[model samples]
Target: MRKTSLDVTAARVSPALPRRIPRLPGRFPRRLPVRQVLCLLPLALVAVVAVQHWTVLTEGFGKLGTGEWPWLLAAATTTCLAWVAAAVTRQGAVVERMPVFRLLATQFAAGAANHLLPTGLGASAVNLRFMTVCGIPLARSSAALALYILAEAISRVTLLIALLLAFPSALRLSTLLPEGAVGPLLLAVAVATVVAAAVLLLVRRLRTAAVSFLRTALGEARSVHTRPARALALWGGSLAFPALQAAGLVAVGQALGLQIPAAHMAVAYLAATVAVALVPTPGGLGSVEAALIVTLVAAGGDAAVATAVVLTYRIITVWLPLLPGALTLGVLVRLKVI
Candidate 1:
């Protein structure tokens, strides 16, 4: 069939019309920035947790009404100081001085991040980014992070041991494990170590990375120790961090009228924390609550009182500051401080 000029023109242009016409900017909404979304995610999660735990949280807050106000206030103060101790330890890990205000803010944000990420990954990531932005090299920043972690672990263990020795009768070591569990536990650890070693030996890249990391970590550790002030800050802050945390628990216990001795409560806090250290939950959430309750009960606290104290402590240290910490994290991210 013969086609009109208009028909021919329409046919020629129709296919290309869709392609030629630009997409209207207003037709589709722009996706939110990844950074903003990420910043909001933790806050959203915090809100979820608060909602889910509303009953427990309300009960915890209610318990505070009957608590010794002074002791509860002291607990809150100690919890706040734990963040300062963390910042000090971060400073001690590197030779270069970080901006004090930023460093402190980063630590505060890190505490919030800790709740969102597993095994303290959030805090580590934040601090590492902060250090890198402050002009520290990546390797050194990683090494500094390692040093901080090692120092913190050692200090926690050391404090635990000291408390145990000082109060031998406080925590019953024998009751912590079943009669025959130790042998199997040790065997399992040995097997795991051997397997890990074999895997590293078989993987050249993994071995190389491990060796390099160890060398850098060792070198950084030595360098940090050379400066007496840095060494003091690192070790002292590490020591104080866990001590203050345990003290906060103790203070909470006292406020809540937990009948357990303060020393026993301190030991319970350390032991419970150490037991659940490898659980990999964010800020040891569920694991921490369970361990604290169990350990406190084992340490001769009344179960009801122990639960109340733990709830109050978590409310004070974790939930209460959560929103503020999340806001601080958002601010730091916006500012590119972390």
Candidate 2:
């Protein structure tokens, strides 16, 4: 009886025991959590504006006409082209070999994520995941991203220098305020704030580990530096693509019946856009609209025209992208790609 009971007990417990799960043959996957460190004020700003200027938003939408459509298309096309160039530029630094289609999808998904989410977390997450999925080790992935970012900065600074040289008046902050000593002080404050923020970003090593990782993957940092000329050329091309985009915005303004100068629009658009980027808002919604309108007005545009031009531009460049971007993000989540 005892032997029989032992056998039955063993059988019952053995059948219920959990099996040993096979371990994945890799370093543990790292999750990049999306943190909304910035953009906390955008919601409140949007709400305040909604309550204060509901009439304008409504009226602005009504003014949207067929004539303005082509400019929107131009803006969208140039923006897409800029992104494509950026992705292609990044391809040289990535350690993992991925198909061009995969790279394109990753770029599209990253852009979608960046626009829809706060603080660029979505795009960053997407980028990391794409690198990981393509069999690049996490460290190398980070390094590749770093190199790509450095290239991007070189390009952006070049574009900014060109704009400043082309339109020195656009850099004048005194025009925005009453011409007192206070104007210079305010201008100094603005310049200092921008410089401080940029320094912080550029100095944050963790934010740009991708380049180091790429260096490691290549066996040495010197190996990565060997193609400096090619890298510079790629970066220059990226810069020009975005300059074309700035031109596209001017075209959009013209389409809206606003006779804005291209050089002035480029400078104002870059400044206002940079200010909006600092707001940390998803798509930089209210802050962007306000900055663009104010900048345009300061650049010799009538308030009504500025309002109309900005609204139409935002509709095409910002809101129009949100829905599709959100949908793409959802698809990425489903596919476990990001």
Q: What TM-score, computed on C-alpha atoms, does each candidate reach?
A: 0.90, 0.68
Per-residue lDDT tens digits for candidate 2, residues 1-338, read 35798798999899778788666767677554443212222334335535555665566566556446776678778777766775766565653346676677677766656655675566677887888887877777766776666666566666767887878776456655566878686899899999976775788684365445545755523444567754543565557655765776787787777766778888778767655655786656577789888888777777888788888776655545544555555565556565
Q: Best candidate per TM-score, number? A: 1
Please give the CA lDDT of all the candidate structures: 0.91, 0.66
Over 4 Å off, model 2 = 1-61, 170-172, 177-225, 228-234
Clash pairs of candidate 1?
none
The 10-residue segment with the lowest total lDDT in model 2: 34-43
Residue 147 error for model 2, in Å?
Answer: 3.2
lDDT of 2 at 158: 65
- Candidate that would win on lDDT: 1
